[model samples]
Target chain A: MSSPATQPDFGSARPGGRTARTRAAVRDATLAELAAHGYRGLTVDGVAERSGVHRTTVYRRWGGVDGLVVDALDLAGEDGWQPPDTGGFAGDCRALAAEVHRSFADPAQGAASAAVVAASFQSPRAAEALRGFYADRNARSEVIVSRAVDRGELPAGTDAAAVVRAVVAPLFHRLFITREPLDAGVAEQAAEAAVAAALAGVFQLPSGA
Target chain B: MSSPATQPDFGSARPGGRTARTRAAVRDATLAELAAHGYRGLTVDGVAERSGVHRTTVYRRWGGVDGLVVDALDLAGEDGWQPPDTGGFAGDCRALAAEVHRSFADPAQGAASAAVVAASFQSPRAAEALRGFYADRNARSEVIVSRAVDRGELPAGTDAAAVVRAVVAPLFHRLFITREPLDAGVAEQAAEAAVAAALAGVFQLPSGA
Candidate 1:
C-alpha cells in the first residue's frame, strides 16, 4: 500500500492529516468488508479490525454497521462521480450510462452494490441512504440536461433528473431484479430510450392526469 | 377460512378434488410462511405443518424450502395472470402497468414477491424460476405490441418482449432497487415513457450493431 504522504488530498485543510487519513482507511475497510462478505455478514468489529482503528473509536464515530456503510457510500459517491459532458444530450446520456454500467458491472463494485441493495431491504436507514446516494448521483448528472437545453437539443422544461434516472433505472432493474445480461448494448439502449422519451415529453409530469 | 369447495378451479381437471385441494393448501401455506418469515426463515417442516400435508408428503413433493417457494411462485404466476386487451398499444401498456403495480403493491403479494426476490439472490434454482416466470409474463403481453404493429403504430419487426420489458423495468427498479414510492402516476410515467421510446426505435436491437 502507498504511504499517506504520497496520497493527494483534493483540498483538505491538511494534506496528510491524521483525521482524514483515518477516515479514508475506515471507508476503505468498510467497502472491502462489504465486497467480501455482503451486508448481511458485515460487522463493526470487522471494519474496525481491518481499518486498524480502535474498536471504541469505530463505535463512537459510526455508532453501528449501517452508519459505517452509509459513510462508505457517501465517499464512493464523491469520488470520480462527474458525468462526462459530451456537449449534447445523447452523448452525455450515453457517457453516463457507460460509466454507471462499468461501475456496477465490475466484480468488486458489483458485489458492494448488491450488498448495499440487500441491506436496504432489511433496514429502513440503509434504504434512505441508498435513495440519498442515487439522488445525489442524479443531481450531479443533471448538468447533461442543462447543457442540452442550452444547446437547444431539448425543451426548456425537461426534467433533467428524471431523464438521468430513466437512463439508469433499467440497468438497475436488470442487475437487482431481472438479473439479465448487462453489456455495452444494454447501456446504449438505456441512453437511447431515455433520450427518445425525454424529447417526446413523456417524462414531463402531465398537467392534470 | 373458506372451504376449498368455494374456490373455483378455472376448469382444471379434478377441481376441488383431494389432490388439488392439498396442492392449493400447500401453496397458500407457503405464501403465508414467506410473508411471515421471509425466505431465509422459511422451512419445509413449517410449511408441512401449516399446510396440513404430511411431513413425508411435503418432503416428497417439494424436496425442500426452495422447491416449495418455486412451486408457490408457479401457482402465483398462473392465477388470474391476464392483462386487459384495451385494443391499442398505449391503453394496453397502461392497463398492464396498472395490473403489475397492483400485484406488486398489494401487501401480502408484495411481501411474498420480496421473499422470492431475496431467495433468488442466494439460490440458482430460485433465480431460474424467477426468469421463467417473467419470460411467461412477457410472452403473454406480447400481444400488445403485435396489435400495435398491426395498427401501424409501431414498426413491423419490433421486438415485442423488449418493449414489454422496457415498459415494466422502471417499476421493478422502484420496487426492488430504488425503494421509491410507486403510485399510479409512476406507473403512468413508466408506460408512457416506454411507449414513446418504443416508437422512436430505441428498444429495437440494431442488425449487427
Candidate 2:
C-alpha cells in the first residue's frame, strides 16, 4: 500500500505550486507499489488507490505508466545505496561489489529490477532508462579504474571501459541469467580476477603491450 | 498452418517410423515460427498450426514450449560454421571471431537466439538449455586457446576460460542488451584484442613469459 501523496518529484521542480508533502507522498507510494507488485503488475489505478489521491490527479501529474515508471526508477536509482569511496581501486571495487550484492539481494529490489528489464525489452522508453542507469554506473566505475591507472597499479593503455564491463559482467550474468545469489566471496573473487587480469594486460595497453 | 502428422517425438524415437525428412520439416517450421513470433508470442498450439503437427504429438515429443525451444535451438546450433584450425593463437582467434559474426549475422539465428535468451529468464528449462549451449561453445573455444599455449603463442597458465568469456562478452552485450547487429569487424577486433592481451600476460603467465 503506497501513499502516492508522499512521493517526491525527482530532480524536477514542483509544478502548479504543489507542496513538498504531496510530492513526497506520491513518490513514496509509487516505490511501495513497485516493490510489491513489480513493474508489470504496477498500475496507475493502484497508485491512486494506495495514495488516496484522485485518479485524475495521478494521470494529470504523471501522464501514464511509462512516465510513472521512469520517475520511480529515477528515484530508486538515486536513493539506492552508493558505494563508499575507499580511496583506491581494490578497495573501491570491493565497496562497489558489496553495494551491488546488497541491492540485488533485497527481494523487492531484485524483483523490481527483473521486472524493469523485462519491460525494457518490450518498451523503448524503458530501455532508454535502463541504458541511462548502466551508463551512470559505468562512468563511476571508469573513474575508479582511471585512478588505478594513474597510480600505475594498472598499465597505462588499459581499456578502462572493457575493464569496467568485465568487473560487473559476471555479477550480472549470475544475477539475471542464473538467478543465483551473489555471495560476497564471489564478488571479491571476481574483482580480484578482473584487477589481476587488467594489470597483467587483458584489455590491451594504450600503445601496444 | 502446421501439419499434425509431421511432429517428431523428442523423447521417443521414431514411434511412427517417420522418415528423417518429416522431422527436419517440423524442426525447420519451429525455427521459422520462433523467429517470427518471439518466445512469448510463440505457443505450442501455434507450432502445431504452423508445422501441421498434432498438438498431442508435439507434447508427446517435446513436452511443451520449453522442450520445443530446446529442440529448435539444438537444430540451429548444429548448422555450423565452426572456427578453422588456425596454426597460432592470432589465427585461431580470427577464426573464432569470424564464426561468431557468421552466427549472429544470420537474421534467423539472431532472432531465435534473442528469443531463447529472453525465455531463459523465466523458464528453468530454457536456462538449462542456454547453459548447455554456452558450455559446449566454451569447450570448443578452450581447445583453440590451449593450442596457443602449446605453441608459445600465449603465456602458459593463461586462463582459457576467462579469455573465452572476455572474447564473446562484448558480442553478447551488443546482441542482447544493445540490440545492435554483431558485425564481423567488431568480432574481429574483439578477438584480436583478447588474444593480444592474453598473450601479453594479462592472466597468469607460463614459466617463461
Candidate 3:
C-alpha cells in the first residue's frame, strides 16, 4: 500500500542531512542505470560511482543491487497508477483495464517491468517482490468485485480471485510475450468482456452447491 | 500436432547413413550439456567432445550452439498433452485443463520450459521458437472454443482467444509465479468455472447489452 512516490528517497539527504542527499543521488543514478543497462547489467558499484555516494552507504541502505533495484522501481513511481473507483463493476473493470493499458504502454514502466520479470526468473527475492506487486493489484480488483457481490449484482460464491486473473491475463500476456502497445480502448474492451463473462457465471459458484 | 514420441530423432545420424548416427550422438550431447550448463555456458566444442562427433559436423548441422538449442527444443516435440475431445463444453475444458496440469507438473517439462523461457530473453530466435510453441497450443484451444460457439453452447461472438487465455492463465501463474502444483481437480474446476462464466455471457456482447 506504499505509494511509489513516497518510498524512501535514495537521493535525499538522510536525517544526518548529508546522507539524505547521497541517498537521493544514489536512487536517481539507479534509475538512469536501469534505463540504460537493464537489471541484469546493473551493479551497486556502478550506482555508487554514478551518484558520488560511498559504496558502504549504498550497501548499508539497500543491502545489494537487487534491493537497490526494488527501491529504484519503487522510487520510479511504478505503483502509483490505480484504477478509478467507479461505482459499477463494469465501470470499475473498464477503469482498471484502461489504467493497465496506459501503464504498460509507457516506455518507462514497460522497461522496468520487463527488467523485474527477467530478474525475478533468477532471484528469489526479486521474484517475491514482483509477486507482491501483482498480488496488490489483484487485491484491489477483488475489493471491487466483492462490492458488486454485496450489492447482489454478482452471484454469490463468485471466485473473485479468478475474475481478477481473467481481467488482467491478456494485458500481462501482451506486455510479456507480444511486447505490444496496450492502449486504453483495448483495455476497455478487455475489461468489458471480462466483466460480462464474470457476471454471466463464467467464473462463478460450483454446481449443486 | 506432433506427438513427443514421433518427432524426428535429433539423435539420429544424418542422411549420409553413417553420418546420421554421429548427428544423433551430437544432439544428445547438446541436450545433456544444456541441462547441466544452461544457455550461457553451453559451447559447440564441448558438445562435439561429449558426443564424439567431429566439430565440423556439429557446426554443419546446427550452425552453432544457438541453432543447436533451437533444434533441441523442436526435437523435444510440440505435443502439449491435449485433453481428450468431450462433447460438452465443460467436458472439453476439463480435458484441456487436465492436460495443462499434467504437462506443467512433469519435472522434465517444467525445468525445460523454464530454461527455454530464460534463454528466449537473450536470443531472438529462441524467443520466436518459444512463441511458435505457445501459438500452436493457443490455436488448438481456439478450435475447441470455436466448435462450442458453433453449437450455440457459448455466446455467438464469444472471445475464443480470451477464453483460451483464461483456461491456461491460472496454470501458468501457478507454474511460474506461485510454484504450486496444478492438480487435475483444480484444472477441471477452473475449466468449469470459465465455461460457466462464458456461457452466462461474461466475455461476449457489450456490458449490460
Candidate 4:
C-alpha cells in the first residue's frame, strides 16, 4: 500500500472517450456485483455480463477481478471528494463524521463497503486496494487537521491521519464490529470524542521519533 | 445478532469426557480450516477430514460450518480470560490494548480473526456469531471500567462498554482498515486516547438517554 503521506494522484478524470464511458460502466457493475456477491463470489464474467461490456474487454483491460474491485473502490471516492471543512475543527470533524455515517448507513453503499472489507481480509491484493483507497482518502483529508493546527486549535506535529482515524474508528467499530445502529447521536459523539482526544494531544507523535 | 449488553453464557467449559474431547478437536479443526481457506472456502467435509471425526458426527454436532466457526470462536476466550487490571484505569486500559494488539498481531490468531471478520461481512449467520463473540468479550471486560468508576477515577455515569470499545476501536481500524503496522507505540496511544476521552466524559450518554 502507498504511504498515507505520499499517495499518487488517484481518480483523475479521464478524457472524454468511449474508453472512459466503458470504464465508468464497468466500475458501477463491479460495485454492484461486489455488493450482491461479495469479493469471494464476484467473478470477471459476472461483472462483464452485468456491465454489458465484452468479457474479453474486461479481462484484458482490468486484468482480473481484483483490478476491477480496486477500480470500483477508486470510483467511489475518486470524484475529487474532499473531507468536510466547516471552519472550526470541531464542525469539520462533525461534518466528516456525518458523511461517513451516511455512507455506511446507506444500505447499498454499506453492502458494497462491507463486501470490500470482507474481501480484504481474505485476499492480500484486496487488502492493498483497500489500504490505498484509505491512504488516498486520508491524504485528501489531512488539510482539515492542518488548517486546525494553523489556527492554533491543535498542537503542532499532531498526526492528521490519527485524528481522522480517531473520529471514524468508533463508527466503524459499531458498524463492522458491534453491528450496532449508527444514528445521529453516534456520529455526533464520535466527532466529539475525537475533538476531545485531539485537544488533549492524544494524536501527537513523539518529537523526532 | 445478540445485543452487546445481553449475551448468552459463552465459552462455558465442559467436563472431561469423550464429548469434550470431540468438541475440542472439532474446534481446533475449525480454526485451522478458517485460517487456511477462510470462511467462504470452509466446508463440513474439510473439517471432518481434518479433525478425523466422522462426517456424520461432525454434521450432527456442529450443524454446519457457521456453527463450528462460532464454536471455535467460543473456545478461544472460554478460559475465563479477564482484562488486565493494575489498579489504575489507565493501567487497565493499557493492558486491554496490549492484549488486543497481541492477538491481532499474532500470525495464526490474527489470520483466524481476520477470517471470522471477513466471513461475518459475507454471511448473516457468521455476522451473528462474530457479534456474539465480541458482545461476550466486551461483557466480560466491562468490569475494568466499572472498577475505575467505583474508584472515583471517572464520573459515575461513564459508559463502561463505550469506554472498552474506545480502547479497541483504533487498533481494529488499523488492523482492518488502513492496514498500518500494529506496534507498541500504536497500542500505547490507543489506550492513552481512550483514557483521555473517557476522562473527558466523551463516553457519557446524555441524561435519561
The candidates' DockQ values read 0.61, 0.18, 0.32, 0.68
DockQ ranking of the models? 4, 1, 3, 2
Candidate 2 local Cα displacement, residue A149, angstroms: 4.4
Q: B110 in model 3: Cα distance from truth in Å?
A: 1.1
The TM-score each candidate achieves on chain A is: 0.87, 0.78, 0.77, 0.88
Candidate 1: tens digits of C-alpha lDDT, residues A149-169: 889888887877678778888
Candidate 3 displacement at residue A138 in angstroms: 2.5
Q: Is candidate 2 or candidate 3 better by TM-score?
A: 3
lDDT for each residue of candidate 2 in B1-209, tens digit (9 for 90 to 100) = 11001011122222244645455556666666766876667788888888888889888887888888777556544433234576877777776666656655656655655666777755678777767666555655687778877887776788776567556655665555534456776676566656655755555534443
TM-score pick, better of 1 and 3: 1
Q: What C-alpha lDDT, on a 0 to 100 scale, does residue B98 get in candidate 4? A: 80
The better-scoring model by lDDT among 1 and 3 is: 1
Q: Which ten residues in a row have the lowest lDDT in candidate 4 chain B?
A: B1-10
Per-residue C-alpha lDDT of model 3 across residues A1-209, encoded as one tens digit per residue: 22221112123222347665565577677766766776667898999899988899888999988887676545443434444567888887776666666554556655555666666665677666666666665665587678888888888788787677656665665555533446765566557656766776766657612
Candidate 2's C-alpha runs over 4 A off are: A1-40, A46-57, A77-84, A90-98, A152-159, A177-186, A189-209, B1-20, B54-56, B76-84, B152-159, B178-209
* Ordering by TM-score: 4, 1, 3, 2
Scored by lDDT, the top model is: 4
